[model samples]
Target: MPKDQLLRLQALEAAERRMKIWTIPLQTPNNRGAFLRRFIERVSDRNLHTAVPAQNQSAVQKAAQFYQSCSLVYTTGGERELSTVRRLLADFGVFWPRLSNASNLLRICFAMSAVLDWAPVILFSLARPGHIVVTPAPFYAFLLGRRRAMLSSSNDGREYKSYFSHMVDTFRRQEPSSDVLSYYELLAMESQIVPALQQAYTAADGGIIKNGTLDDILNLAGEAIPRSKWDDELGKNFKSAIPNDTTALRFVIENVFFFAEFFALMDNLSESQLAYYVGWTAVQGLSLFTKPAVINFYYPSRSQALQGHVMACGALSHHYMGLAFYANYIREEFSAHELADVIALVNHVRKFFREGFSSSGALKEFIDKSQQSLDQNAPFPSAASAPLSFVTDSQEGQLNELFRHFPDQKPSIFDNIQSVAVARRMTRADTRAANFRWNGKVRLYYLTDDKRFELLPTALEPPFYSAEAPPAVKYGALGAEIGDAMAALVSMWLRDADENTRAKVYTEALCRHNRPVIPVETATTQVPSWPNISRRELAERVVSLNAAFRAFLDATDGGNQYRLDGYESLTGKRMFFIIWCMAQCGASYGKQKCHDPLRLFRYFARAFECKVGSVMSTIRECT
Candidate 1:
């Protein structure tokens, strides 16, 4: 074993005794397969263990008749276990050519099994109460590490030690990664679990391990408890309570079952071939343990040196990286005058936002008197409505406060994880210090509930931002972004009203400014819903939104004062409108759904000289 893995196990063993908290058995490599035998090993999947239900039996049996001649296994394969395996695959309509490697065939069977069984497995995992470890294969190495820790119990220690040792030995024969993220990029997921699970599930007075809080389970796994996970409603909105009874909760897991459905495709493989599937999964999961040169073949140029340009940018962007990256960005792009102008510009935007365009009565959102700007130097991150109700309102002081306990270790997988864990803990502890976004906190980064915004210093750079650029260029990009944010603020300010009223507030606020209503739509094409409003309301809503900004644009020419003629051929009004239109130009198409609504903005109608009832021009009012 490498020194690092060796030491890691040794350290875990040593540390387990010093802590007064509970511990699990020493995890050793040798015991991998034993737990599989111990687990009730049943999965919720219907296809894997249950016969085809009557409803589906007709179709399955019908399909089974056509492929009967293929034979389950070839005459040439080994006889020791071939008969039993062949019969199993044949029932599922998984016939093999008489000529193939055992493991490959088993893998095909595993995949078929998985397709039939994914739902029950996912359900079992989501709702189950005991030993809910998610993985493709058994985690015997973890068991070995657990056994080495040797948690004390007056009666169980000796038995646990023996069991743990045996499990470790079995695991060494074939082991799996603790967990893996199959997310396009392969990242070996490391967890500090088990103890948390034991605490949550096991009875303190020594009863059966039956239940625990959902929050505790997620926390132990270093994951946040999203509101939807416990949802009893339409799986989106969060429920405040968890029900312990049968009506509220569904599946129960008394033992570990391979969520074999995901792997059922591998069933065509021979027993040895099946090991290769697990072996490859382990390889992907443990690739980090392999040399970086080998790992980089799969993922090139992803991770970087701890203090390089990429990391510096990442550190600046991530809450864990704190103000260091911001400082680095400032140093690179900011001059003394540039810094001052940026600050002035920030306060300038804030002042304009706080005090209204025409009159300050526009936005009445309950937020801080002043918000601090920490120039997200890169492609910026979003902000919450409450806006860092946590950070101090200063760029310099907030940076210092942001990184107070940020661990000062060289970049390594272990240190990075530890740093994040500490930073997350700090979010709950020193929240009064400075606002940190990336900690394991709420569901999203930028929320639209309250009044809040952050500064994106990168927006001030070229070709997006340049101090020397013409007003058309600047406003066309960054200025338009500011305008968009203003629009978002208008939308957010109305959020306090009841949902319907909120929609009315946006439309009314837009039309109330009386810049130029797009005139309500006459005929309708397919426009996507805007949260609560109907299609007609959304058109009026967009026009109304532009009305307030129209007033802002009308008040200025080339950003100096509004003029009918902008620069040369384009008028100031035209430039402001064009820049605003161009700034909001991206959308996504997915699942036969397209959500690009920017074309509906009246600017396009006016630009194209549409009279009315055209694609860009609407005749319907929001009311």
Candidate 2:
């Protein structure tokens, strides 16, 4: 054989060997407690690095050098330049999935290079969803490296270099929080904007009202953006480069409309009410840091294990060591048969959504569109993986063997946090070196993305799923939740035109509820409201719809019916409803109703009261 062909064959075999080191046997079958004891004994400073067998240790160590040749990159949606990060990762054969301008990416590059072994999961944050503004200094510094493989022997490297050079310029002095500014600026500029709007309206009406007065109302909002520094901060990267470019700003405005809407509500609030809003919100964020004070501030009645500062600390510690406990949780609560059952349940639910959950009614047309939207989520392909398993199996503790939980009261909280920071950096470096190859497996707990779902072991706990659970109980609890998430995925599948048509259908549905009671409810309300006053019950309807689907798959024709189990002397349908309601009943009423003008729904009221003609009640059939 030719020497070149022989060398290539050796490299291919070497790569396969390294891949095997990434995974190892975990857990001892039927001896979960003993397995955990042995597992904890294996904790060490190095975790994922132990994947290699003793015989191949030297070879594995040499192969890990491949991580050294590549660079990792990340910039946010705020930057509007995924190309910067894209090229960096591509240098090492890690190709990112495509994303539209509207889509967001959560790119994490786990570095495996020798220099920064401590850098665990280097992640990217964006301005999407509930993201708040933070200094982009860290992100800026993270992007300062060349990513192309040192000796790719690639066909062309010039274009790649050019992309990198341009990206460097873009990252320079690039304020990451610029996108956040565009969103909140309108609120800060409200005083100027409202007058301008009033003047425009008056001018359009041929001076119908004089001097920017709409019925003598001088309107404004929100404490002038927390100090006169609004323009300098907001102007750093907003609408300045393109000079009057409002495209990115408009997107932020549309997506974060509710933020401004809430600010507008300040007009209706009293001083104390305003204090309550600002004070509690500030406390909630700060509570994690000063948990003891927060616990003490609450009444004595609130003294539960989950209420105290200790509990807050406990939760974080538990998460830091979760993988160590994952095996035990699986052994104690999960089984292979049960896990298979849940997988089957998930598949069944997915199939139901694909078929529009077997609908037939005015809602059916929208359901069909939703299913299509779900099937073809764009900019990236969708595939399901078994992130969860029911615990019918164990071999030997693998990943947990590498983990060491923090010593209690040893490192100060700040020190612990800093250590985590280092670990995360190392993890991200390793992941980057390993690259973004999806091997059809995911970790148990992770933030969800547009492309996939991650099911955790904790999800198997009571009320969600159980090995002994009837199908009805399973569907009523975790099944509903999984179904709800699936429905959300399907909703994204909607075409723009179909979305408008569905909106019209919903508009007409709510129109039937436009009774005289709405105005009375509005006056008693405390926020400057948007329209859609009659749609307050839509949430309840959604909850009802999930219940209906759970009890009998095709409620329209009763194609699949759950037989009665006689729980609480109730039939199958009522048992399912009761279980579902009781599961949600644990939340405090304040949590339910806050930010929602329509009172927190009383589950029993909806399930039993049969309010006038409302659909929330069990009495209102799916049709």
Candidate 3:
């Protein structure tokens, strides 16, 4: 080799040696402390110093020179240094893998570098379902730096950089779309390519009612954009031309105000309280997003109505996932103050929304309408409202009244739920039925008592009703009514009731219900029994099955494929529904049975369109 080549090889070899030496496990009291001590010692002795050619050093050498004077251990303390590195690793993708010993410097560097390589995946991972990624100021700041670096480079990869840069910018501004649902600002403003909506809204002097920015107006004003303003010729020229759902929009307006009030009230909460608020807030988001679809039974089942409910439900589910992430992150680090804040916020939100629940809204509306009709011997209200074209005068007055009552104190989750329940109720009301009119305040009172019964764990099988039959009216009209109440009660229990109260309700609803039940597991049946399944196992199975079916349908059916082959769709739909219910299981099961086997089989039946008459028979005869 030439002299220069020999020198370059020697330098490379030396650098590799140093990398290996740095990662060697230090025998110190704490793993972090050991690393810090080594880093300090190396810095003190200037051991990291590299003698590169003065005139023609490579890019790596230039970068190294820039870092040389800085403390390899930049923070004031060892713990801080370890934490910083760990966060960077977590953010990049090199999360702390389970290991017993400290890694060598080469291994650590390799891991960190791999994490850097997978940064995109890591960022997207933050958007996982039922998880909320809390981007603290420091984390966002770090991302901003990374974004700047990415932007500076003009490679094709810069598009990805731009995408991620947008995400980081949104995070800093507290408008992360990874968790957006009801918030219009979050959906509209966070996009990199989307036009600046807030500026546009302000510029037009409220002339245009943009669909993308609808959430902003509702949040700012406790009403939808006035039709007079939105109906302007210029408004038609802008992006607000889409026909928005008046009912949902009204609900959003009311609830946004409620949320704002609740948040303001919670500003004084302790750290722990805040943490709980974070968790509960996510749960609330889940409930809200899923509320529309879940409450469809009460609606007249029109296509547009169904679509609105489903879309809203999905958006809520997505937001909840984000909240879950935040909750999981903060659970470990929450202080007493945060805990206090969480509890306070939960209580506050719950209290605030009680009125909405008590009103003629949601399930209560269904109940109220039905009861009144029965009182007068009239038919159930089936006529759908005219697309809820706009919020009624009454809603505007109510919102104004609420604002007056809690001018300083914002409404909480309870208030929002109440608003949603009320809004949904409005969507279902019989405008002409004097008997169905409910003018009283709405309250969510529970029918709780000490009772337990073994629920079938699954809905009843055929002879009870073939898969082709419409969903069994087994819960008769009255029973169905009670079941709706039970669902609402159970949801509320998960939110505000005690574990025992929840357990009591679950036991009664499942165990004591008036129905012949099929055993979840077969003991002396014709077919061999599946192994006993844990709740965790069950959850995994359901998620896997849903994913599989979703994939299959996406592949076969034009992405949104899934025709109701009569009740065939019901089987698969029921399976996913079970998964949904199980996801929010809470203390409902109470050790009665895992209910996994039945759920799994049901999912399979739905996916494959298998007839389960014999299976149902076997389940019934198991005992």
Q: Which candidate number maximizes TM-score?
A: 2
Give the C-alpha miss distance for residue 460 in model 3, angstroms: 26
RMSD of each: 24.6, 21.9, 29.1
lDDT of each: 0.32, 0.32, 0.27
Error of 3 at 274 (Å): 17
lDDT of 2 by residue, 435-472 (tens): 10111111122323343344655456544566555444
Question: Pairing residues by index, what is the TM-score of model 1?
Answer: 0.40
Q: Per-residue CA lDDT of candidate 3, range 1-623, in tens?
A: 89999999997676555333322211112222233223223322331254434444332222222222121222122443333433443332221221112222122222322222111111111111111111111122222333344345565345433343332332222333333222233223224211222122112112222232434533443332244443232122211212333223221111232223322332343223322222221222222222233222222344533433333322221121112111211223334343333223222222222222243223233223323312222321211111011112123343233223111211132222223222222232212111110111111112222211111101112111112222211111111222333333334324454656544433322222223435544445344343244332332332223333333233334223232323344443443333223322222231222243333334444444434433422222111
Model 1 misplaced stretches (Cα beyond 4 Å): 1-292, 299-319, 339-407, 411-416, 419-450, 490-493, 509-578, 585-604, 620-623
Worst 10 residues of 3 by lDDT: 434-443
Superposed Cα RMSD, model 2: 21.9
- Report the C-alpha displacement of residue 499, candidate 1, in angstroms: 3.8
lDDT of 1 by residue, 270-289 (tens): 33433333333333222222
